[model samples]
Target: MMALVGPVGPVGIDQLGVYVPEYVLPLDQLAAARGVPVEKLHIGIGAQQMAVAPPWEDAVTLGANAAARAIAQGHISPDEIGLLLVATETGVDHAKPASIFLHELLGVTANCRTLELKHACYSGTAGVMIAADWIRSGAARGRKALVVATDIARYDLHSSAEFTQGAGAVAVVVSEQPRLLALDPISGVFASNVYDFWRPLDRREALVDGKFSVDCYLNALDGAVADYRNGHSTPSGALSEEFAALLYHTPFPKMAYKAHLRLIEGEWRAAGRNPADLGPAAEQSYRTLVEPTLGAARVVGNTYTASLYLCLAWLAEQQGRALEGRSLGLFSYGSGCCAEFFSGQCVAGSAKVAAGIGVADLLAARRTLTVDEYEAFGRDGAGADLPVESRANFCRFAGVREDKRLYERTGSLAQ
Candidate 1:
């Protein structure tokens, strides 16, 4: 990993775009199907709905769609992108990097550097940091880099993680003069070798030590935040006073809320203040600074590598004009595990860029699926019985043939 030093100028997100699949599985339906109370899913798990990709949709299609949207929204020519990095855990191929497919799909220049990154959910933030460093180092002078986080979170049927399963992608364009959040080059990271979550090579879904995973998540957050504050000489109240919002890599909203509480209590204790005395105030601050960032993730569930960026897009879209000049604290974590605490300041006119992405419209336009329908969709992995031909105009995963993964692209370039 490259060292993170302060950049000479603002270098961060120039444009952003997100793609959630058209299908949605409501939590109420999931609870009903699982023979549980609706509140168990809605309140207990902190997920309201989950975005579900069809048999024909996977990381590649979702990523390509998001990248295309970012390129179009930024008015960036494909040839102007010098680096294309994809962060994903649910890659379609074991040996081939997903960014190679994305590069060809998006029509990026032949000279572009392309690769895929994996560190569980933290890979996306890693991609963003690397792209920013690449530009700041003047290696890609005058050219923009595309960083994408795409994933599908899946577990075995009727499992605790089932409610958290979701699929989506977020694409960001990075350049010197950013239209969205301008990143601080200095970041704090904490990594440890722990197996809270993992998937064996032969398994299709992840095996998680649920309680252990939660513990690791909170511990990682504490370590990262402490390191960040100490490295920067930040005071205890800096988190509560300086940052307008706090975003987390959410597997679910309730987990993020717990992490926020831990952060607040940690800050108070480190400052020699009684955490018990600050309970009500801390809760209020968490609601104010963190709740807004969860709106989208609550609806989309856990998107693995895409989770943190999804929170960022949600915050940008929800706060809009009010976000200008305000700083944001972001926490990125991957299970096995790596965590980073970083900050970014919203540049002027960031609201315009956020509004251009049309996330609200996309969510509104999604098709809600009944529990039976969702189950059926999940079972039909090969998409042989479905009318995939109707989706030919868009990028889709055509069924595998002769043990080879196939993709269909009707148009020359993604619209």
Candidate 2:
């Protein structure tokens, strides 16, 4: 079916805000507490740090922070946001959209259609694309929409997935003629494979055939990129070797590395040349952009769908370098399998993008516990589900007791 390709609608992200909890968790500390080899937490995975949010800050608070920060940075107004879409896997309620929480907590206008989208990590892009289409439809009429990606990943204690778990949120406002990064509508996606990964509600961690996941990712990546490149007759093909940078979802540092390598290998083979003969050019590009981005990912553990979005955020924050006015190829892969290959044109607004929280501050904020302590900390079970306290960070369910949750700021206001 031919979807409406609009009247040159210039839709893109207007502003971006980030929310990270004040707490930090050091992998070295985790090793110290677990009695595991320090290298396992260090060089092996190369993870130096992670963010740990208090029970009070769930997906909603994290999302709110990003949204508020975007506003604080002077981008859009609450009145301009006609739609609120929260794309997250770790939702507070299945029946109700978590977007409602942000709307109520932030006191968004009543007319906004608050909703949540779930499709693994692709949900964020889904939200953005939908907003883009809305703008293309002329339905926005200058109004904007809020798209938030917030997640808390926990893979149980001592599980493979555990090392990749991270908590944070990325909020972006989408509108017509954004001054920041301009998103190109051209995208390639692949659906219909469920064998790679999953985490059911009954289970706390995910079950992933690491190798299988990698294969699925590579296949989707190549197919989507090739199709897009072939369909559009652009210079050197978007999937060709020339682009500003390539960014990926770093579930575990090595995971994306393998996929990146596979891309190069396939490219060499397609040209009917020995991969070794391609020299360091191809390898270097992937190594420079893909590697460090994945390395930074190690500290985060896995954010399920939010992982790739954070990788992009991390890239935009690094200083003294230049990426403005360049095109970045992005591969966003989600388990239970969904993937997207798209490109984002980096504009001149990185000064704003840099304002987001950095790796150093986030890692520094965490409070480490012994592995036993971590197990105990996680086991603590949202801390005393009391109903009378006021919690400043207020989690999704259960009010604060005595100033903890029961006493949280209510929308009705006090008498």
Candidate 3:
């Protein structure tokens, strides 16, 4: 659409697609009933809203929606799509790659390379990294790569982290010499110790220490930032004071706030700079984002792999073109204690790319579920059938006779 201001690179997110189901669990309501101030959950996890997925929305359905929209908008033909990737711990099948289902729903070419990746929340970024390399290699014969990061964040009912649960997806299309901002060749990544979150196949909820997870986020955030700063040369004119917008891996919105403020504090103290010297714009930008982050994310909770990208979607909506053409800082952290620090330029098309979602309409269209409905939805998986509310047609349950997977086609490939 002539919106991309610069030459594209192999690694940049050319088009981004986001999908959050209509149903949401508002945090203030939860807090009021829990007999505490809204700030309790609000301040505790930095989440104000969390989106819950009923049976109708699964990783397959949500990821398909996001990926389909991105590809269609980018004018990519299904025949030219060589890689179909679905990265999530909440994958549809333990044995089968979720990409197969995506292929069926999106009508990707039969010759595609389909694979499912798992590395906690980092799986999505991992998919992007590898797909970039694949595109750069050009061995796929003019084919582009499509990666969908989808997940549902669930903790056992009544767990402290339970309120942070969310479901969503972010789709990215990577191609060679494309339309979008170019990615920098250099990036920073680090793997710290692991202890925060993990769940086995049999378990439905996540297990973790909230303090430990928060501690990991702060340490990883600082660690990655320090690594990037130490190795890279800064840009001229306010390298110390200037940055476009800082987006962090939002396990929850409040957690990101705590980490962001801590980063600002450390940055100011290290430079002997007055925090207020930067003026209200910088502070307000960060505040406007992180303050309502918890509230905004409380309803959607944590979408795991899609968490950070989902934050980018929110930032695009609120920040507008002010962030365009500027350097955007990002921190991505995963549960296994993996973290990466990178920067992306906000090209002219940033807002336009983010403008495709019908978030308000989707929110209005969802069917809200009570605690009982949520429990039923959460518990309906395994060698069994999907719950009554499921609307996943492409992979509908057909009562397992043995251990083999059987899929029922719902519709044509929409990719």
Candidate 4:
């Protein structure tokens, strides 16, 4: 990993795009089917629905769909993208990087550099930071980099993590003079050899120690935030007071809320104030600073590597013009476990660009699935019976043949 130092100029996300599967399994429906209380899913984990990808949609397809939207939204030509970095844990092939498929699907030039990054959920943040560094180093030579975080979160049926299953992708075009958020060059980072969560190659679903993962997450946040504050010596007020809002790597919506609470407790402890005395003020702060970021995640569930960026998309879509010139604190965490705390400022005209993205509209348009239908999707021999809708210009996985995985776009890229 490259050391994060101050950049020469502002370099960050120029445009953002997101793609969620059209199908969703409502948590209430899943809860009823499993004989679990609905509140445990709705209020406990703070998830309402989980997006479900059809068999034809893999990480590559989902990522391509998002990258296409971003390219269109940014008015970027394929030749202008000098680098393409894809972040995902749910990769389709063991040897080929997912970026190669995305490059073909998105019609990028052969000159572009492509790579795949994996660090559980933290890979997206790593991609963004690396892209920014590449621009600062003059490696892109005035060309932009496209970073896409895409994943399908799957778990064994009837397992503890079943309700968190979801599929989605988030893409951002990174360049100088960005129209969206401008990232601060310095980032606080931490890593450890803890195995709180992991997926072995033989298994299709991930194994997690839920309670241990939560503890690891909180510890990583503490370490990252401390390193961040060390670099930023603010005399005005508490470090938390410097940001308009805070966003965290959300495996689920409630996890973000917990991350915010941890920040509050850390600040209070540093000031020799009893964290128990935080009272209603901490709750109010969370409502003001964090609630908006969770709206999309509550509906989409855990997107793994896409999870953190998904929060940023939701915030930009919801807050719009209100975010102009304000600073935002962001934290990213990946289990096994790596973490980072960083800051970015909402650029001017961000609202206008954000308004054009249509993230909220995409969420509103999803179709709900019956519990039986959701279960059947995981069964073998179900793929042939599934109908593949031809979404214009969207890529779909056309089953493997002769050890070669096939892909096709529904509509022409030239169109």
Top lDDT hit: 4
lDDT of candidate model 3 versus the reference = 0.69
Highest-TM-score candidate: 4
On residues 1-415, what C-alpha lDDT tens digit does candidate 1 reach at each position? 9655554578999988888888899988888889889888778878899998877788898898888778877788999999999999989889999999888777788999999999999999999999999999888867899999999888888987788899899998999989998999888899999999998888878999999999999999988988888778874655877799999889989988888888888878878988889858877988899999998888988999989888898889878799999999999999999999999999999998888887777788888889888888778774545453343234666677887776666554435
Total clashing pairs for each candidate = 0, 25, 22, 0
Quantify how close model 4 is to the true structure by its C-alpha RMSD in Å: 3.1
| Whole-model lDDT per candidate | 0.86, 0.68, 0.69, 0.88
**Residue 346's lDDT in candidate 1:** 97
Rank by lDDT, descending? Answer: 4, 1, 3, 2
What TM-score number comes out for model 3? 0.84
Per-model C-alpha RMSD = 3.0, 4.8, 5.0, 3.1
At residue 263, give the lDDT of candidate 2: 71
Q: Which wins on lDDT, candidate 1 or candidate 2?
A: 1
TM-score of 2: 0.85
| Candidate 3 lDDT over residue span 1-415, tens digit each | 5343343344566676667765677777666655667787767665676687766567777787777667666667778789878988887677888778878767787899999988888788778777777766556566788889999887876666777788988887876654444455556677876888888777777798778888877887777677776667641123224456677777776667677776776676576787667556455767654543233355577889988777766666556567677766667788778887777676776666556544444545666666565666667644445565643333343445576544554543342
TM-score per candidate, in order?
Answer: 0.95, 0.85, 0.84, 0.96
Clashing pairs in 1: none
Ranking of all predicted structures according to TM-score, beginning with the best and ending with the worst: 4, 1, 2, 3
